[model samples]
Target chain A: MSTTSPSRWKTVRSETGRALTALVIALAVALVVILLTSADPGAAFQTLLTAPLSSNRTMGLWIDDVAKLTLTGLAFSLVFQARQFSMGVQGQVYMGGLFAALIAMSPIGATPLAIPVAMLAAMCAGAVYGFIPGYAKARFGASEIVSSLMLNYIAILVVNYLIRAHLAPAGTGQLMTAKFPDTAIFPAILPGTRFDLGIVIALVSALAVWFLLYRTSWGLKLRLVGHNPKFAEYAGIRSSFIMVSAMTVAGAFGGLLGSVFVQGRAFGNLAQNFDGNLAFEGILIAIVARSRPLAVPIVALAYGYLRQGAQLMGIRTDVPTEMISVVQAIIILLVASSFSLPGKKLFARLRGQKSANAATPEAAK
Target chain B: MIELLLTVFSATFFVTVVRTTTPLLFAALGGLISDLSGALNVALEGMMLIAALTAVIVSVYAPWYVAVLSGVAAGAMLGALMAFFHLRLKADIILVGFAVNILATGGTVFALSRATGGDKGTSINLPSKAVPGVDLSFLEAIPAVGPTLKSLLSGHSILSWLGVFMVFAVWYFLFRTPYGLWLRGVGEYPAAPEAAGIPVAKVRAWSLVASGALAGIGGAQLAMFNYIGFTRDMTAGRGFIALGAVLLGARHPVGAMLAALLFGIFEALAIVMPNLFNWIPGEMIQTIPFVVTVLALILFSYRAQRARQMRTLSKI
Candidate 1:
């Protein structure tokens, strides 16, 4: 046990070191892009690095971005861990937001139970929306990526149709629902900022997912299926059931994000394309976090900081904020790439030690 | 309903379907080639988008055919980059595909702003040339079916005709040649081909390049002929739809063309419905192609599963 602990610590240290290296390299790539595009590259680069910390407002936005990305990141991590590439989170967010807004505007929203009730409804909506692609993959052998993408377009259109046809107040020019009642709104946790109970919800949700993925038999079964589906099936595990459940639970997280967006001060009403590309951004966060439930929030925080800074840079300089996406793509490619670095021998030795431990009977599962 | 039927039967609607199907057909063919090579090119969306913008920007300075060729080159280069990352560096193909998409989305907007001197939403300010439509008004000189043939076939983009020829060409290349068999063998079971002394990795890499080039032609058709200018996200999920078309076409070249045409018909309906049915929201109309793609894919999967089960039962 003592020997295993040291090796595990070494592995974690090496992983962190690699991640840091990747981040620095990604930033350098971003610097090159900025230099090529921006007339005043120095200001743009500085703004991209420091703008998120310059003001309370930016800080609030950054925190909100973190909270949102964390939830979506967890959502992506769950399905990805199950080895199911479900890109339906964007659609689930739209459905979740729609249901949450509907519940919030209903007469029941006047009660103190409104937020919980609305949130529950939103989660259920998201789960059902997620179930379509999950069922398609498990039952029909359909590709979840393509099916989920189709569902995303349909979900967006459905949400827009609903907002335009039924949810929006009559005579309003915009495609948006009426604002939620004050009782339904999540109160700001910080004074003069948009931070609210959603942040707490996000953190709690992250911890919950960690416990769910690490501390439960269900998680063990899910991970077992992910590691080897044929082996899991040989061991009497229903791989299909786990895949669906993973997606359904991940969908619940997407729904929670939707509810948070609509119920919080960030958007008190549902609108067409309100989620923007937030759900898609989660995929990057999930990959960056290495699909670890516990690591999602930290990665989200780091990414959210950069994203907020990029927005500020876009506003302040000629360098487009889109430059950050170029950096992001480069980072994802570099980090996800399996290259032999100088420490490769040491890393392989540590992994060999871990594999030797895995030869134990209990570890063989 | 009668008016809708009349519109559907008319030559103009047929023209719209052909025009719409041309881009999807190109992308779908690209997707089919890669899928046959065992590498699912999810970057078709990003490739098409970037190519569309490249075509638009390049057409402003060059001949339309050269502009189209530039789009193809841009897509082929992206394919090579992806091959470098996925094959050499061992990056996951899907993640790398999404990375390309992210790059395309953000990169295109950044480039557009620079090109148009600040218009990030579109390349409207750019004086891009269009692919010349094939004039077949001479068909009217014939006797009976003259006007009908002219209306049916005339004025379509020259690339649209190329799209039809490419379908047959891809079919012949994928099935009729020894290289085609090798490509299929590589995709189906690389170990067998590797043992057989074939360059399996090279085959897959070249498949992706060809896939990207095909999708690039689709993008050129889109920006150069379909819309005449690049808008933000102008591919608008057509690349994805082409993926569905690849599957719905049963992974065959002909099947892909049919599936693309199927989606094309729905797209044409969506475009035409907004005018006829003022009662239905435009958003609902726009969803028809996506809805049909999902339904068709589900049905295709179901049938395929049944076929597999039946074959196993027969063996028993």
Candidate 2:
């Protein structure tokens, strides 16, 4: 036990080192952007470091962002865990939001009575949107990445057309539906913040996903299918069905995120491209967490804080909030990298592998 | 509808189609190169956006050709960076490509604001130069056919002619050259080439660089010739359409050009249709190319599958 403990500790240490390296590199790049763009780099960096935690109000804002990002991240984790790279999470979200609005606005329903119905309709729409690509991949040998990406553009445009044609109130001067009813809007739970019960739903769903992935026999079979599809088929597992269901489940989570977005009180209307970055953010969060459901919410919160801080930095300093995108990209590159300096032997292999990466970064020129 | 179709087939419409097709063709060729070398460049959209901004910004201080070269250099550097992460650091190629895309999306906005002194929406405020259109007025001096040819082909950007020449060039390089054979071998079965002492990774690296350079030129054409200014996300879905074109073209250079022209015709139609059909929303009309991409891909895949099954049956 003692001997094994040391080896385990070493692995833990290396993992920690790699994570820290990614953080350091990402932050350093962000800082360089700040220095280059801002007149007062010190103040800019300070706000970036502390603005998310500066006040209860800021904290609430950060957590509200985290709630939505967590749900989207959960949506991506479902498909990613099955070894299927579905790029349709945003597409599903777009469908969900549009369907949710349509159902909520239907004449047959009372105001409060329609919210749950809207959520269900949204989930169904998302499922259908996901199923198209799922079926294509399962039956036609088409690439999920390409099909889903095309679907995303279609979904966005279709939703945009729907909003303008049927949903938008006359003379609004913008392509958005009218305000949702009071019953549709989620109220703030925290006194001084936009934090709402939507977060509660997201937190519960993350825990539920964790349980479903770790403690269920279905999870085991699904993982087996992902680990080796041919072996799973030999073992009588319906791998294609699992693949489709994984996408369906993922779509459901995306739907939930959209439902939450539309139900906010102050900003209850869905706007153009409001679903921006959430899909990619979901992918990034899953990558950071190694696609573990339990770790997703944590990564979402961390990313949420950075985004909030970046926004604050934009307001307080000369920096742009878009800098966070560059930071996030670099973080993803570093974290997903196999290079590490923890072990001397491992370090040598990393150095020897590339003229681009290790020998000369200037080789990119 | 027949009258409308006839009206749409004028020299003006054909010229618009050629103009739209040039950028798509360049990007499609770029996609084809990387794809043939076993690296699908999903980052074409981002590369084009960055290069568009780069070319537009550089055109303020340099010659049009120099600005275009700068854009190509920027894209090549981005491609090299992607290879660093994908090949050396061992990240998934798609994910790395996506990261570059995300970086481009934000980085371009930040850079635009800096360059334009606060405008984030476009580079409209800059005094950018455009690629000169060729004047074939001499065709008017020749004869009867000269007037027709001048109307159809004259006034096109010089880049458009290069784009046409590039189609044949890419075809010859891919089908008639040793390096092209090596690239195909590397993509199909890298092990065979590796055993034969070819540097598979190096080939892939150079293919990505070439891919990026070509896409960069496409961006330059979009900003410097087609549109004459840079807008955020102006490449729009053209990069993606180019990818679909690569597949729809059956992954061949000549096919890529034809596929690009097909989409470009729809895009040209979109540009003109909104004025004619006042009732249909412009956004809805703009989706024609993307919708066509999906339908064409589905049809292509279904047909390919049936063909494969038939081939197997014949063997039996």
Candidate 3:
């Protein structure tokens, strides 16, 4: 506990080095895969890492991907921080997208008001969706993981049924919903690019989450509850309330992601494979970021780059884009393993101190 | 109405149920073994997917049995890898399971295209061999019950027969053997076994590998017999369903078998119903199995809760 400052720095450096080593190992495996399958491994690697940043348009796509991943990652981070494994973010997103599309298509309000209303509806829908599992777990002591996982399939199937039965536009047979009106569309920040105001919302949301989880008394209570519910209860904290609220907040974040994707990117339409596996990707990003709200955006950007790079690799070389999935799997394996290592306790202590110091700055002011 | 009922109970429906249940039964057994040992092998889905592809690809060159064995070996290797990471490297078991799943989802497709010369969806063009069905025509010579027995048991894959035997073998191993007790003790409370000088990690690791091998066999059944070829996402959530079955079966070997059979019945219906009821869409029909899984789980949970409540009431 009374180690020298240089020694502490060395410890931090070593942890970072271990993390980088894991990433390097993953990349090496990918490189071997590329070498085996493709004509040139070096060129494939170069294309994968650099091509996403090569042009404005490609950069914008990368940003768009990051925005979506950030939103989902933030959702997962919030829930995970409470020690709640809510795997139904995928389901919540489906409901969110559905509600957003419904709002966008309905002639209920003006365009300016309609967008926010749609977003709010989506958030509320997601919150309600999450509340069921949270309530079940809190009251009945049911396993949230099993419930959440089951609900995901139900949500997908329910959405699929709705899209095919009522929401589908004329001449559409692939179970896709009708496109929203032009007025419901999100305004793009970059011309001729997918980048939209969603990026700003995602960044602002991360900042808000960081503040909420650090500066507030409730945040401290939540953390205490997450770490040890019995101790938190003894400390006079309402653990159930925190659990429900945390889950609702997590769900709202998931809803926001889906709504933003629908309004900004997909133009308020839902496809059969509308999920795009973003929820899973978000889980990976959250794990990689160690469930830190602030770190989500950074990790999400890296994920976005990797995804874009994988696509580029697929295009330029014989390497299939699915290699990205393999890389993600390897990274999770490495990261989860790293976290369980003996040195991670020291790393957590350091992180705890850093977060505590960071929390005090706004409090002092 | 009688004709419709007859059609529902026909040989085709029977075969469909058998085909659907074979893989699910194997996977359920896999899940039960690991779970009983206190290691929930969530990677069953991923293992099955990879094995299905492996079997399909390998069958192009080797015999169907060899292909199936290759798939099982692949799953065993993955299980060993999981054990290495989780037991030795100290990784989270769930995370390791998910990593395997993610790898399977992506790796299978990548390898599939390479194997099939860039086809991503189906391995129809590949000369993959089918699992040889058991010739039970000899049963017909056994008198009156012979034809009935042949209809019930005949034309099933060789792997299906192995599945039946493995169930009994697994049950025997768990109930009678010293290793089974050690595995169960490790799962229920690792500290007790650790105190007794039994290597807790080693038991869990072997359980995971065994689970993976069982799941791999299930995958081979799916590719070689169920559909006769591999398709992208052909398991379609059966692995997860098998996980549910593991619980619904009360985490016992026999219970898993019954649960698998029940789900197989629903899946068989789903497959057969679309053809019979022209009014119902194929997608809706296909969703029956998943829907039934949720309903069955809910009922199971409700009953468990009720049983607990009753016990408390009796105590009071």
Top candidate by DockQ = 1
Task: Give per-residue CA lDDT, model 3, range A225-310, as digits (tens).
Answer: 77778999999999988988888888888888878878885355766658678777887877777777877898898778889888
**Candidate 2 error regions (>4 Å):** A1-16, A107-112, A342-365
lDDT of 2 by residue, B1-316 (tens): 7756875878999999989998999999999999999988888988998999999999999999999999999889888988888888877777788888888888898899889988889899999999999898888777768888889979998889998998888888988999999999999999999999999999999989999999999999999988888998898878888888887788899989999999999989889888788888888888888888877777787778889999999999
Candidate lDDT values, in order = 0.89, 0.82, 0.82
On TM-score, the candidate that comes out on top is 1
Expressed as tens digits, the lDDT of each residue in B192-262 for candidate 1 is 99999999989999999999999999999999999999999988899999999998888899999999999
What is each candidate's DockQ, to 2 decimals?
Answer: 0.63, 0.55, 0.42
Model 1 has how many clashing residue pairs? 1
lDDT of 3: 0.82
> Candidate 3: misplaced stretches above 4 Å?
A1-18, A139-141, A172-175, A215-218, A233-244, A266-268, A339-365, B1-8, B309-316
DockQ preference between candidates 1 and 3, better one:
1
Q: Name the lDDT value of residue A288 in candidate 1.
A: 74
**What is candidate 2's lDDT per residue for A141-251, written digit by digit as tens?**
666777778888888888888777767887776778877766766767976578887789889989988877777877777777777789999999999888888888788
Ranked by DockQ from best down, the candidates are 1, 2, 3
Considering TM-score, where higher is better, how would the candidates rank from best to worst?
1, 2, 3
**Which regions in candidate 1 have their CA more than 4 angstroms from the true location?**
A1-3, A340-365
Give the Å shift of residue A123 in candidate 3. 1.7
lDDT of 1 at B295: 89
| Candidate 3 TM-score to native | 0.90
- Residue-pair clashes per candidate, as listed? 1, 0, 0
Model 2, residue A19: distance off in Å is: 3.0
